[model samples]
Target chain A: MTPIVKPLIKTEALTKTYGSIIAVDNLDLEITEGEIFGFLGPNGAGKTTTCRILTTLTKPSSGHAFVSGFNVVEEPVKAKSGIGVVPQYLNVDGELSAYENLKLHGMLHGMEWGKMKMHIEKMLEFVQLSDRASSLVKTFSEGMKKRLMVARALLHEPKVLFLDEPTVGLDPQTRRNIWGIIRRINQERATIFLTTHYIEEAEVLCHRVGIIDYGRLIALDIPEQLLKRTGRFVVEMLDDDRSKARFFKNREDAGRFVASLDRDAIIRKSNLEDVFIKLTGRKVID
Target chain B: MVGTYAIFWREMVILRRRLIRVMASYAISPLLFLIAFGWGMGRSLQVEGMDYLTFMIPGLIALSSMSQTFSIAMDINISRFYWMTFEEFQTAPISSSSIVLGEVLSGMVRGMLASFIIFILAAAFGIRLNVNWALLLSVIFNTFMFASAAVITSMIVKSHADQASFNGFFIVPMSFLCGTFFPLSRFPEWAYLIAQVFPLTHASSCIRAAALGMDIPLISFLVMIIYSILFFLGAITCVKKASL
Candidate 1:
């Protein structure tokens, strides 16, 4: 097999601190080109901070990162040119129409009128917003606005796109629609770096998932590998009135039941939520 | 820059759609100030060669720029937080400098438009069109400078409550001490120092001096330039440090 290329983004001891609290701490990370990398963590686990630093939106307190072969601190504009970010909060101008927004964004990158018009039409169509191209964004539904946000981000044809909780407030159907758009971007060879708390979202969309807790990377691998390595099938039965005496009596039986199964399998209950709790020593808030 | 022009064009179109409200807001205060302050002062003793209305006309023009430009600054923040229009700028490839320039340029356009309307009203009231090219240029330069300063003010603001603080602490004080409603000669030494710190002082003095066809001091011009540079730098720094 051909050797895989080196990472497009590399970080060494990257840290961001806010006052007395550490937002992101001593993180070493690498993200390859043409791959969808998902960051999964509970709220306030520094997922957004990590994304902000990589996108050149916020400066890190210490250490450094490189994007598209340019250092974020030393060559921010070059690094910024290679990235497009869709923040958790909506940033679309309600006053401008869908076309106007895309046109302005394209112009910012110095695209010519002829090429911009053609590209704007194609992108609007790609996001299924062609019908409402002239409608004011303030009049758009949450889903429609979200789609336009994606279209605006893609106008510059950025090599890497960062999305922070892209589907946080959307309905399930809308969320799925956004997922489809993300997948399409991936197919077109744009590397995606998204931060999401939804495990199902990471499992469905990300090529590789990184689980961060307390500002540190705890697990980073394919979703299947994580479940396979740390999770087990759980057999839940009704609790009896036999109490502690019966519980001790059934210990041997439980051991035999576990011994009868495949060696690779363990008779234990564990899911993503369980894994999160086990690692963080706190119950998953949601 | 091309990006700044694009943003400026977009802002113009948005303002066009809200033309009725914008025009109404612009006309309301000048009319009220004309009827109330001018009439109230006219009933009393005559101050100088011109009527109270004529004296207040230039003041009204400067006030409109101050109020409108600062409000535009605040409006951008409100739109970013409540309506989410800021996302458009964030995802776009434009530099923060371009964003700041675009917004300030739009405010400058608005200020000039309102000031022109005040000039027309003053002419209708039999006030002379006292044209001093040098001083008029200074007034305009200061007006644009203050517009940029207002935008910088909004960039540093953390909440809606900051709007009141900005208006009460900065805008009101500057309007008073900067000679928007009175001449700079009436201000004391320390007050003059505080007044010179803002671009508005240069703006109001330049306009007032122009209306009377009086020569402005070279020191005022130098101070305005210094204030303009400081305010422009403040705006750039504010945008660079903004998290959202």
Candidate 2:
């Protein structure tokens, strides 16, 4: 018999309410070590709220959360020590250089001076900001600022990292660069919990994606399996300003479906966005 | 403690980078006040036993410390709204107490720097008085009181304009009427009662007494201490509340 490994991050019936509105409702989740879990949701879908609760930035209205086996609410300092958070907005210290920003984060985590110096160098190199280490953050491009934020979050080598919309508003090349960094970090066996509304981002980077809607977890599975829930292939018919889609069990069926349509239609593999639309009756970016 | 120092260290780095700007800010107003009030008006008039410049030096120190400490509110607002750096501290393992302490200490440092600028300006005007430990302690207390107040106001105000309005409504009036320009005895009886309510009044009284080589009144020291404690508590409460 094999023993079951406990999850590195777990939440039991976690909920948060702002007066009459429930931001997160009866949420239950478990993410094991080394797993890259992506939280997919639309605007106001409580993705950031869950991250806030798990990261110990805000208290849950009820229930509990644990990060690296430490209860977030009860042992917030310890939980915070184990988890690193990169918020959605660019929160870098603009007055300080890239190296100084990372160094400040390390010092806040109580890293020894010798270790901090080495870690700052390593992080600057990891994010490809080594050349800009001495430059103030205000002078950096938006992409560079995002990379610096990632470096700051990872400076302490945390066991779990929470990235909230890490690559939002970046150019395509920069977004892909950030994706490569996230994949490289996950390859080192650090659990990553990311929340993003970018459907392609979740499809390409996340091992398992959780779809949330109206403050509820609507679906949870691997991207392939979730896509399978809708169908194996998609037939999209483009109109003047709108598009309609149909799902089928196989490529042949999808091709037939496209042929039967009078308008121009295209057949392709189903993706996480299809799953999200099927589950929530709305587009991910709507 | 490491976290607290980290916060303070970041402030120091920025201060170092903007050293010229900070020095100018500290020096310009006090220079103007000395020129207009002490050099221009005080050369002819005598209110107390000493020259007007001597009497106004302590008041200027108290007023400068108050304004410098209250300027922390603008820094906090900028960090919270524009840069969002306060969220970095919020998500770290640092305690609320450490954040408050670090910010208040930075405010105190600025307050003392502004006082020292005024001191140099006073000397340039040929007005020198006996600066003692009591005078230093009074300035420290005054700074702590206003710094804590700044933190509270920063948390409560929704916008930078709101913070400016707070200065316009509260700090501006206090600067002029808190015995910073003249003695409270010059005010009418009802006005004197109101002036006594401002913490800067006690600070000005204690600083002037100490600078003149006179005995510092125990009650003024006690009042300043009590106000510092209350404002410090209020600041901590606001920090915790804002984090939520």
RMSD of each: 4.4, 1.8
lDDT leader = 2
Worst 10 residues of 1 chain A by lDDT: A241-250
CA-based DockQ, model 2: 0.69
lDDT of 1 by residue, B132-243 (tens): 6865676566666777787687777776788668788878777666776666666688877777767777777667767767776567777777777777778777876773
lDDT, model 1, position B28:
80
Residue pairs of candidate 2 with colliding backbone atoms: none
Where does candidate 1 stray beyond 4 Å? Answer: A1-4, A236-271, A281-285, B43-45, B186-198
Q: List TM-scores for all candidates, in order.
A: 0.89, 0.96
Model 1 B-chain TM: 0.88
CA deviation > 4 Å runs, candidate 2 = A238-242, A259-264
- Across A1-286, the per-residue lDDT of candidate 1 in tens digits comes to 9997878888999999999899999999899999999998899999999998887767899998898888887776677777877888877777889998888788777788898999899999999999999998889998888889899888878899998999988999999999999999999999999999987788889988888987888888877666656544443333353211111123355566656645333334345555565566654454
Question: How close is candidate 2 at the interface, in terms of C-alpha RMSD after superposing the true interface residues?
Answer: 1.3
lDDT of 2: 0.90
lDDT of 2 by residue, A1-286 (tens): 8888899999999999999998999899999989999999997999999998888878899989999899987877778887888999999999999999998899889999999999999999999999999999999999999999999989999999999999999999999999999999999888999999999999999999999987899899998889888998998888776888889989999988777878888888888888887887789987
